[model samples]
Target: MRAYLALLEELERRRRGNSLAVYKPYDRQAEFHAAGATNRERLFMAGNQLGKTRAGGAEWAMHLTGRYPDWWVGKVFDQPVRLWAAGVTGEGTRDNPQRVLVGPPQQQGEWGTGMIPADAIADTVMGRGAPGALDSVVVRWGGGGDVQAGESVLSFKSYEKGREKWQGETLHGVWFDEEPPLDIYSEGLTRTNATDGITIVTFTPLLGMSDVVLRFLSAEAIQGLGSSPPQGGVAA
Candidate 1:
């Protein structure tokens, strides 16, 4: 009897823990960029802690788990997606992008507490690099009563692995949590070309006028820049 009560309490806690309110964009800019983005390639470039990474991570969670909120107006996939989330190095990728997508690297028990709801997490494959980091995660689609629902895969990648490592696989989406080199970025672009897949980048423009930054800037300029960084806008 005691065990049964404990189980019920645990389940209740998880139910309340997965509320969408925990992950909503903090401002209009974040809301617009995360849900309003229509471009095939989108860049959320801003200064530190302005919710750039948070917006990107939230959108990616929606895409991967197929659990979009009612307010979502961004790109939607009819089927399960295969995505790559990348960063500057193995440790950085694990600590930042991977952490945002699936929770803390060192805390396996806390895996489902990030942007991904606890119930949507299907399984995780452990990676060899960076202690307790994940190589990939499988997200269970709620199906929403549609026939296309299933498990979506999120793979962890590193820019330090080079352009060659980015080659070959055809992906549904790619999220770069940091500005990647031109060659690596180009390789990522190629992987998504066949599927008309989307590429989302979230970064601080600390590199100033680098090639990757210039690509987004040349087409459309970032707006409303202030001391604290643009909250959550996207430039494509």
Candidate 2:
């Protein structure tokens, strides 16, 4: 009985300490990851609090660290990537996507307990203005052999900052945690256009058929969504 209890405790410890080690995406998550290969811009539209944000975080973690699960079949970056993960405000980002990727904002000691493994977390730079918010993270990318220094950077941004903040930098990818205004969304897409990088947006339909939502609900995309359950992502 003692051994069994000890084993259970250890498993729980591992699960919390390095959540990424046990990450197993559901059917929809796998489908979303796989869809990234063909679709440059994909929208994961689902109900709020339904793991859409979690999916985005998991994929972002994989890309930033260049550490993909053996069963992963989604988009894979050959080298370490420069990516952005954003939400509505500093607090919203800190509470959701940021937490998902880097663990609890309040608990700096448990930083790597999120989707990105602890050892792979190279460093974190605190963002300005926002209290207890992270500006960016340096992840050790296990970019095998040919790839350089093996480090990738993940930056945090907010839609409230406007589209200009999103300009300038050429990104490997962008993950939008919630529905962004059309213009902001366009700017994000442009950032990746030069590199042929991907743009992934995961959000609920709060805008109710707004431009951003409409873009993903094209005739074909709508048809795809209706016909049987999609594994992940609908091309737009």
Candidate 3:
């Protein structure tokens, strides 16, 4: 029947959308994500719309849910992790990091269609002040025959909330989807110090030569590196 065929098509689309096997990162993205294994700090500076956020989001999903693909050569956490993903403001955070990690913020049922696999999403807590935005997400780990292993946590944050908001919690990782103020950036680093956790910053260098940007550039210069410090970018 016509209706039955339509339904089948929809189901197929959802199946493809939820599968991590469909993700194929380009060479630069692969290197960026892989650096987390040895680097405590990383910066993915690129032009706009070059898939920087997408690459970062996918890696965060893997860390939070322990759902790395067999081809994954990135950082692997032995246990469930507590991570924070942030942007410049509440709305920006929801639109960028939240959308990439989960799904469209305005869509209710399509939440698990993003980089995070549907089966790995355990639950979500709605954030304050932003409608349809998630305050945090709980991800189920250990899918290889041990579904009861543990749960990882991913929290959404914003730089507009100030450095004070970034304080008080020791986290396993932090993903900055936009350029953060220096104070906010410093606080985020401090939060992960106890865990020796990683901080991944993915942003276009619109605010050219800011302290955070300079920090990475300076490091590269001091080390006389051929590649960009932390990771380089590809053209959009």
Best-to-worst ranking by TM-score: 3, 2, 1
Point out the higher-scoring one by lDDT: 1 or 2. Answer: 2
Whole-model lDDT per candidate: 0.78, 0.83, 0.83
Candidate number with the higher TM-score (1 or 3): 3
lDDT (Cα, tens digit) per residue for candidate 1, span 159-207:
9878888889999889889889989888898899998998888887776
Point out where model 2 deviates above 4 Å: 1-13, 143-149, 220-236
Task: Give the better candidate number (1 or 2) by TM-score.
Answer: 2
Specify the highest-TM-score model's number. Answer: 3
Task: Give the Å error, residue 111, model 2.
Answer: 0.6
Query: Candidate 2 local accuracy as lDDT?
Result: 0.83
**Candidate 3 wrongly placed segments (more than 4 Å):** 1-7, 10-19, 146-148, 219-236
